[model samples]
Target: MLDMLTRWYQRRFSDPHAVSLVAILLGGFLTIYFFGNLIAPLLVAIVLAYLLEWPVMQLTRLGLPRTLSVMGVLLIFAGLMVMAIFGLVPTIWHQVGNLIADVPNMFNGLQNYVSSLPERYPDFVQPHQVSTFMITLREKVLGMGESVVKGSLASLVSLATLAVYLILVPLLVFFLLKDKEEMLEMLSGLLPKNRRLTSKVGAEMNQQISNYIRGKVTEIFIVGIVSYITFAVMDLRYAVLLGVLVGFSVLIPYIGAAAVTLPVAMVGLFQWGISPEFWWLLVAYGIIQALDGNVLVPILFSEAVNLHPVAIIVAVLVFGGMWGFWGVFFAIPLATLVKAVWNALPATEPPPEEQVEE
Candidate 1:
């Protein structure tokens, strides 16, 4: 067993590049595991810098200096951030508060409906079963309410952290964008002299991640705006809240849409019951989702990472379990990084078969 293990190590870790890659990956995982929260601002800055790089390059191509180009992009980003904070945040917060305030009423209505379920379908649902379900549901709802309250209190306590992120992220993004080439050069200098495989993998990951993040941001804005207009036209309550939910739902691909649908349907049901207005609202929502999935996604992500559906889902599950929301958000890109590295690594050729009389 010892000899076999030694042979395996010698065969696999023989290449210097392979050994270096393993060390780098282990080091990276350890760093992220240990200081992930502390370095979140830097990670966010890196993502923002990557997203803004294209526009900055376009400006540079149009005869602007790189510094001026980065400044212009940063200014636009800052203005947008300010607008979101001032214009959107307060409205969303109000809607969220309203939603929370109405939750108890919603639960009461749900309980009443569940209570009547047995009468409506006596053969299908017994009163005792309904009672049991209602009890369980009530407990779950109470638990959810308590969790929300706790989360709100926690958020208040984390205001300082949030402020740090707001300040530090922009500053880091600015410096990163301004010193992009120099930074790349410095990082590259740290790597082995013969780093063709590493460079290839890095280039591929950079392209895929940039396209994905930029395209996703655009998709969210487009979907949110469209959903908001549709909901407002239909006189739906919590239109902005639903719109934002629908917008961000695009982040998790298959899961988000399905999860968000319950709330949208519930709100519509309570608002319009079995009316044509409710049906029309649902139809419009469906159309928007269809257009987003079938049309908008293809257009925006024409050059996006081509991940298999199963692979994407697995990545989401694994990363989400590991890092929660950010993990879910970065799932595809992380998966793509894995794919790129796998492709970059040199494959071992099978040993040649020795033939005698055959």
Candidate 2:
């Protein structure tokens, strides 16, 4: 047993290219396993870099110093964030206050409506089932909201820290852009000695990843702004907020915008009372999504994320089951990683259809 194990270890360590499969598998396993803890912030940093680096690069090309370029991009994004908060927060707060004042009436109306349902046509859902679902849901979010209230002020305090992190992200992005070659060399050196092929493949993978990240960020911004503008014109409750949500959610692909639509649309329906305006709000979202799905995403994600819809969905489900929102956020990148691996393998000769099993 010891001799067999020793031989296996020797074979594994002997040839770098031969061990590629093992290394890839182990690395993937570790990334998936430790992703939420080790990867989330690093991924966030990469995203911020992609967002800021375009203007940074352009400015550099136009004769600004690289540091000055990064600084300018940082300032612009910061101003936008500040403007969004100022414009959106107070309105959302007022809506929340109004919603609180209306909740009891809404609950009473809902109970009356449900009570009428069981009486008007029996043999279906009991009131208890309805009550149970509501209880479970309230238990989840309000229970979470309790934590939110307690931590709200702390979260406000974290703004400064967040700003610091944002600042760091662009700085890191600038350095990544400025020292791209040196950084690649240093990172690639992590492979075993003489692993030239492995290092070259790894560098190629990183290049794809960088472009994908950059492209997706641009896609999100475009989708978000378009949605926000449409919603604002319709005067939807928290239009800017919901727009931000949709735009941000659009980054994740299919299910991202849908999830945002639920709470946000509910808020609109709940506050606006479902008139033509309410229906228009729903239609507005459908149109925005159509625009996004038909145009914006196709243009941006087609190259960056070449995976089929089924593959993208499966990645989201598997990753979401494993990690939740962060999983969704990372799905495209993960899919791209899968595609890189799939394409790297040599294609097998096709079997004759006649000889294949029925």
Q: lDDT of each structure?
A: 0.85, 0.70
- On a 0 to 1 TM-score scale, where does candidate 1 land against the true structure? 0.91
TM for every model, in the order presented, reads: 0.91, 0.73
Error of 1 at 82 (Å): 1.0
lDDT of 1 by residue, 160-223 (tens): 8989988899899999999988999999888777666667677877888888889999999999
Writing each residue's lDDT as its tens digit, candidate 2 over 1-358 gives 9967766556445555536744755676668577755555555666677556667878999999886777678778879978978987787677667655666666566556655666666688777777776677657656766886878879999898778766666567557656656876896566556554455556666666666767767777787788779888887656666767787887667888778878667766666765888888889888888887787776766655367889988998987777777677767776776666545543433333486666
Regions of candidate 2 where Cα sits further than 4 Å from its true position = 1-18, 21-25, 28-41, 63-68, 79-102, 119-171, 193-204, 272-275, 321-326, 347-358
After aligning candidate 1 to the native by TM-score, how far in Å is the CA of 357 from where it should be?
Answer: 12
**Candidate 1 regions with alpha-carbon error over 4 angstroms:** 1-14, 303-305, 348-358
Supply candidate 1's per-residue lDDT for 145. Answer: 78
